[model samples]
Target: MEILADQTPLPDAIDERLRSQLTFVIEVDRLKTVLRQSPLAAAPRRENDAEHSWHLAMMVVLLAEHSDEPIDVGHTIRLVLVHDLVEIYAGDTPLYSASTDQQEREEAAADRLFGLLPPDQAVAMRALWDEFEARVTPEARFAKAMDRLQPLLLNWMARGGTWKSPGVTADVVRARKAVIGEASSALWEAGQVLIDEGERRGWSRSGS
Candidate 1:
């Protein structure tokens, strides 16, 4: 039998223009996010962009068994990992910020960060980022649903509104879950369960 070899290009020094890629690694201290619970089992009260991405990566690996839908687990994992790379440039946006101009700002930030890579890498990465943003494809939808669901679960488990620093209400939480419904009815139902229990037990404030 003849052998078929894999062909892949080796990575060389990425060049000067790719310096924009370093923005993601520049460590934006202003990008604070997700409050931590002092007693989070194995990992306690550690909140940062790196930690958030790490958790999302693990969520894709560990909770995938409960997806209730066949999906590319690897792709889901990648999406979660790359989803927030833009935060490096755009900075983290609070979930409940009253500012009416966030969308435009974040979108512009996405352009700057994703546009920094090599043309090919930048295109692929941007497409994946955009797909995650659009939340229309099956993989993208599932990924987005989890992105929202995880914080809510963490806050509830963290003893109520730990991450909802701006004040989260049951109705507001429900509205967040409502979008998940369009993505996956099953996961959305699960979100409802979490939200309902959170409200009943005061993990999230009711009618706040």
Candidate 2:
């Protein structure tokens, strides 16, 4: 039996624009190496930035109806997917860990990583990331809600996975959940149920 080879060389006629886009695509694969504090729902190992972003994108699709304001689902999905590409360079910062310079580091990483694409594409992606960070637009708000919700669901599924961390308190969890409420009151109510359950189980600290 002959074995089929899967690898293929790039076309000789590929343009510089396509080359740049492909370069950016290959570079972002590094996001798989940037692990997060939140573990997978059923797996013992932590999820990487790539997995987290993909999960959030799916959540945007499934939960868009819960958003308080109407949102452009495609744009919201774009925000979640591109929001964490900076982590490919800046690295993941655990939610409970203090990092005074995290914003500065991530901003620099965004500049360098996003710059790898064609000019127009780079600007467009960078704008999505910026909009997500700003959290002012309806799509950004809903996207950010899913960003927080994904980990929260994982923690609950893992029986307070990262909530067991030393510095993570019920107050901290509630504070984070506030963003969910800003996006969707129904989602916030659901999150509060999990928070209450976590508190009862003693998986989360009671006070701030």
Best candidate, lDDT: 2
Off by over 4 Å in 1: 1-46, 162-167
Query: Which candidate comes out best when scored by TM-score?
Result: 2
RMSD of each: 9.0, 5.1
User: What TM-score does prediction 2 earn?
Assistant: 0.93
**Candidate 2: which pairs clash?**
none
What lDDT tens digits, residue by residue, belong to model 1 across residues 129-197? 888888767777778777777776667667665434456688877876676666567767888888888
Over 4 Å off, model 2: 1-13
lDDT of 2 by residue, 18-46 (tens): 87787677778788889899989778899
- Please give the RMSD of candidate 2 to the true structure: 5.1
Cα lDDT for residue 140, candidate 2? 96
How many clashing pairs in candidate 2?
0
